[model samples]
Target: MALRTVLSDPMLRMLALAVLLAVIIPVGSQTRPAADLLVSAGVFVLFLLNGMRIARSEIRLGLRNWRFLLPLLLWVFGAMALAGMALSSLGQGLIPPLIAVGFLYLGSLPSTVQSATSYSALAGGNLGLSVISAALVNIAGIFVTVPVFFLLGGTGSEAQIGWESAERILLILLLPFVIGQIVQGWTRDFIARHGRHIIWIDRLVIALAVYVAFSGAVEQGIWQRVDASAWTWLGGMVAVFLLFGHLGSWVVAGALRLPRPDRISFLFAGTQKSTAVGVPLAAILFPPEIAGFLVVPLMLYHLTQLVVAAPVAGALRRAG
Candidate 1:
């Protein structure tokens, strides 16, 4: 199969990711920092575009589902905390907690709209619930992330919660989302007529963001702190985390007597973390050096889950 064809396969996104990393490995070391920052800044627009496409009503509806959500949130965070403890016992020390905390926040993060809806539809989840869940998570991100960060020791124990980054998220990500909602309502016919063209633009923006962020991370020599053994450990950790996330979600869904469809939604949506969201958030959360380390486990997890979950999701779809 051709390279693009292979990449389009969810199972192969990991291979594509490997290629992305390989390209970044050598050149990332030599790139200028300013260029990287500019690119990173530019990537935020994709978040905006995604936000634009989200319906405000979805967010409003999310409040009603807090009953279903609160328990799931607790389960994910609690499990991650336990996993962090396990990692620490295994000589990973503080790294595991850091990774676990990062992941717990990652778990708490807003769900992806398209993916959640698609998976929910395939797996027999409440379509409205999926939409509302995604919106709620994102809206909560604006209000809850900073406090959660402090609670989880992400921003340090004494770190004062501020509105600076949250404001940026609102401006950079939320503004375009609101505009998109307007566009959808006001010029629904026009957008429908040009929807295909707009989608391509959206994709282009996302690709540009990925390239720029990777390049910036490279230019910053972020990989210098990681060695071959660390890579090996990370690879193993990602695999385990992927396994744990999916299986744990499945078990929990079953234990709760959730229907098959809701189980599927819970299994995939709850377990899947978005690098698209995580990377930029990490940069905003930490200094370059700290962000680099903080993000590595998440980046690894993001890639692994995509690669593994794509096939799993597809299989679930086919079976259904």
Candidate 2:
């Protein structure tokens, strides 16, 4: 039972898969063509499944909660952007430029849906609020991210959203998601019965994306450029960033005088970054060489948030 619990833990599973892929895929014989195709297909399917899982009622509920939703959005997109810009500017020499860019990009992302909602429920939070808030933020992020990136000076002429990239995003991510939602009425039963399997699919896609990203980085001699001390510093910075983000959210929640459940929802939803969306967007927005570096902060933040938030959620649950 304990072993199963450990294996089933999303953070543990993600960490194991990422570490394994980072080590193996670089040395393996997976060609670039194959990796690209696999990563693209995986991202498409992942988003499709996500769309199918979210019900229309949830969307309606999310839209109605303007009082809570407005503040959450401001914190996620506005305050976080300021925090990221501050970090990048202040740590100019301390951290690698690309890694700092990674931090900025991470800040531009949306809150996580599955893990955030799950943790909120476990922490005895308002589960509906978590679900609706997470869903709404991600949907908004799809359109908002490009402008946010440009505003942060993270994009250049080459990185600008060309017709091809926009087409790819529409066809690969949005189209299938629309199809999924359209068919949800007919497929609702099957989705409910087998919805849990989607978790494995999500994990597999993330691992594959990590593997492909790292493989490209390895080919670009990422190791020679980023040494051990750099990695150590990057890891420390990521930890600090996540801790600060969580505590800041807590403070904001308190100042607003939010109820306990809403506060718990705010903490998890506000602090957690979406790896599922961030990885795919990075792959599309940046070249392979830099995409790997850009995603490193995201991966680190994802893991760190989970580790820190899990215990806090448990404590909240116990106290409740």
lDDT of all predictions? 0.56, 0.78
Best by TM-score: 2
RMSD (Å) per prediction: 4.9, 2.8
lDDT of 1 by residue, 154-188 (tens): 55421233577667656665665566666656655
* Tens-digit per-residue lDDT, 56-77, candidate 2: 8888888898878888988888
Model 1: worst 10 consecutive residues (lDDT sum): 88-97
Q: Write down the worst ten-residue block by lDDT for model 2.
A: 153-162
Off by over 4 Å in 1: 1-6, 9-44, 60-62, 65-67, 73-108, 124-128, 156-167, 174-184, 187-191, 197-213, 219-224, 287-289, 314-320
What TM-score would every model get versus the actual structure? 0.72, 0.90
* Total backbone collisions, model 1: 5
Quote the lDDT for 162 in model 2.
Answer: 64
Best by lDDT: 2
